[model samples]
Target: MTEAHAGFAPTGACWICGGERLRPVTRAIFEFSAYAQQDPELARYTGATVEIVRCRGCGFAQPAALPSLPDYFERMYDQRWSDEWMEAEFRDGTKDLIFREVVARLSDRVPARRRTLLDLGAHVGRLIQLAAEAGWRAEGVELNPRTSAYAARATGLPVHRADLRDLEAQGRRYAAVTLIDVLEHIPRPVEALLGVKRVLEPGGWIAVKVPHGPHQLMKERIRGRVVPGYRPTVADNLVHVSHFTAGSLRMALERAGYVDVSITTAAPVLPPPGQGAARAGRVAVRRGMTAAARVLPFGVRTPLAMNLQAYARAFV
Candidate 1:
């Protein structure tokens, strides 16, 4: 094992509630080479095993132990893609449905005069571009150097490669902020939300989207039982350090001082173009699931709730 793997430390408290009563859920080995097939830089830690634990206080799940490396997340996400791949990602329309929903919701809530928006963890600035077209003065905050540069060049807009606290220090404020598929990867989610809140204008709205962690895990387990040679990969190598349910996600936002929080089912990414019957069938299933989830109460626990979409206002 690498020193980083050998030096793992227990997560002593719940990230959301600071609860010490945690129960072991499962363990999974990290086949780093398999996961790194596309990003060869992550192949250094090949044999690390991670344990997931659920907090009894809030029912939030997270890694029982965390890697000792200080720069673990940075190293894990340091992908080097070719310019051609980046261009393709920039033009992909799979997530356009999600981007449109978020923008529409924000436009309804935020006033026209205060239409500045910030997209946190902007991958290729696709959403920012769409928001710009929708008449919002949109910008982004990306930590990855390559993606930040590419997004800025492609969109002709500012993409700051700085931490949220740095923007807060600079008095940068926006009427709306978004963290799409970004919160799951962060640890101490409550603290992260608080930092995001600091950069928002008073009464500004924040939108977040994350996978329904427990439901996703259940699906993976069922698939493993029915499919041949299938391995569950939800919390492998602690890539997703925090796993959230509907209740836990709301609790995190509330504890971080957000008010008027609302959560619903988020739209799924569409399949690539021109796959014929298979793509059509997948789209039908996904749309049906999303529609089913919308009718049910947000507090109701259901498998149809594949992903959670949350909007809350910072009402300080």
Candidate 2:
């Protein structure tokens, strides 16, 4: 693994809209040493800092500086997990609400005959399994060899360890594709989306879920103020490289040639194990927020829309 201590450079253009009207939103010291504790690959850049900037034109936020190392993201995400932990993750139902919602929505949009689905970044193949159970001929594209192999073994499905371009080159097409919690990690979201468009069948639907960047930031700020000795981790180490508002996300899909776009509040990942009452209360509050956001006019602009879910079709 290559070290990137002083290898940060400015991303001069906005990732979503390609605009130069960017203003700094926040700056934080990214302690690579702390991350290195999990993945020793980052042991080189022990002390580093980066600025996150928001694009005035598109309401999208991104790290002002990108690592000079081209494979920085790959190295950063190359996590080594024990099989025990992976197994636990595979069995975790905390994300079942999200997976079920996506699968149900995709099923409703695509006809039964054209129910072939591809889950991009299918971590551990949980979504693939659920989609399969839902009667979709589901498969996945996962780059990590460990997770891809695990997913294939666990689900008895072909989890391709290839990039979207590679899959596109193979002439594979699907009725639907999903990018749950995936797009925000990519710096060039529109370019990646265009690649997704090539792998879809004509008029194929795409389901995307991403955190509402501005609202999430506000929540974190409030939490930090309320909780003593708390620190915000939303943009830590630029893990979430692209922060998107609902408008920006819809615009990104449209710019990538997707039509019939619809954006709404997405389901939340259930909180980790805790007291039954507290967990239920949190889930109830989150579900209520999502339900309310679905009905409210201009809901995407409200703070209740903490996460954005979008359904769009590739141009016919």
Candidate 3:
């Protein structure tokens, strides 16, 4: 295992299965300093050769080296969560739709006498608000001081500036835990899932949404061939430390003492793929494909969909 940068170091074993054997899938020298700009002096020392590696045993692929959680959120992931981004997110309805799907899946399995929901990485508490609308007493846990305060004020919910490990330490428990596009960002996913299990009440459920890794790899490969150093364009390589497949996600949950893990595809509401004279035609084609995907069985849709979710129940 090779270190990509001075700060970023490779995990000796697989993050999902703890397997020792890993093979390189693709290699890209990630320039963290160039996240927002391409600085000539800063780019030289900051460039890290990131190799996307896969477990020989479990087929899970992730970066060879990645920054720790604290370093990433504070320094690297500097895209301002501005008001414009919030308005766009609301307009897009992507987050709301994902929350609805998660809520629907967990509604039936919620533990008796447990009506509370804890949302990890709940930026601005939008999902917390939605969970409240679904009749759960929802509160959020965020790590960013600014977002946590803003969310608490904006939504009038208990948005604490803390991590899941901190919540676990305080002996808090919830009937449902939601992590929308969050698991992939963690440096040690197995440890994080273990913490999630500890914070969950018996028979509680965890609903998670993550980018489909295989799809992302394919997209990146296509783009990288035409444009050099194209990996940064896709946000996953920049922020997401771990890239998950369906098998790896289920295995991680089960290893953390969760049972009855179910992985499903989250339907796509993406914009049209082209422009110009045939713009309307492209939109119709995209809509038709999305409709067909929705009707298809899980086995068929799991690979084609852009995103996937895992629903796991804590039996311990």
TM-score of 3: 0.81
Which regions in candidate 1 have their CA more than 4 angstroms from the true location? 1-6, 34-44, 298-300
For each candidate in turn, the TM-score is 0.93, 0.94, 0.81
Q: Could you give me the TM-score of model 2 versus the true structure?
A: 0.94
- Residue-level lDDT of model 2, residues 256-307, one tens digit each, is 9999999988998888665689998998999899888889998878999999
lDDT of each: 0.86, 0.88, 0.72
**Residue 150 error, candidate 1, Å:** 1.5
Model 1 lDDT on a 0 to 1 scale: 0.86
lDDT of 3 by residue, 248-297 (tens): 88888888888999887664444433455586575565445545656787
Who is ahead in TM-score, 2 or 3? 2
Q: Of the candidates shown, which would achieve the greatest TM-score relative to the real structure? A: 2
Cα deviation of 191 in candidate 3 (Å)?
Answer: 0.8
lDDT pick, better of 1 and 3: 1
Instruction: Determine which window of 10 residues in candidate 2 has minimal summed lDDT.
Output: 38-47
Arranged by TM-score with the best first, the candidates are 2, 1, 3
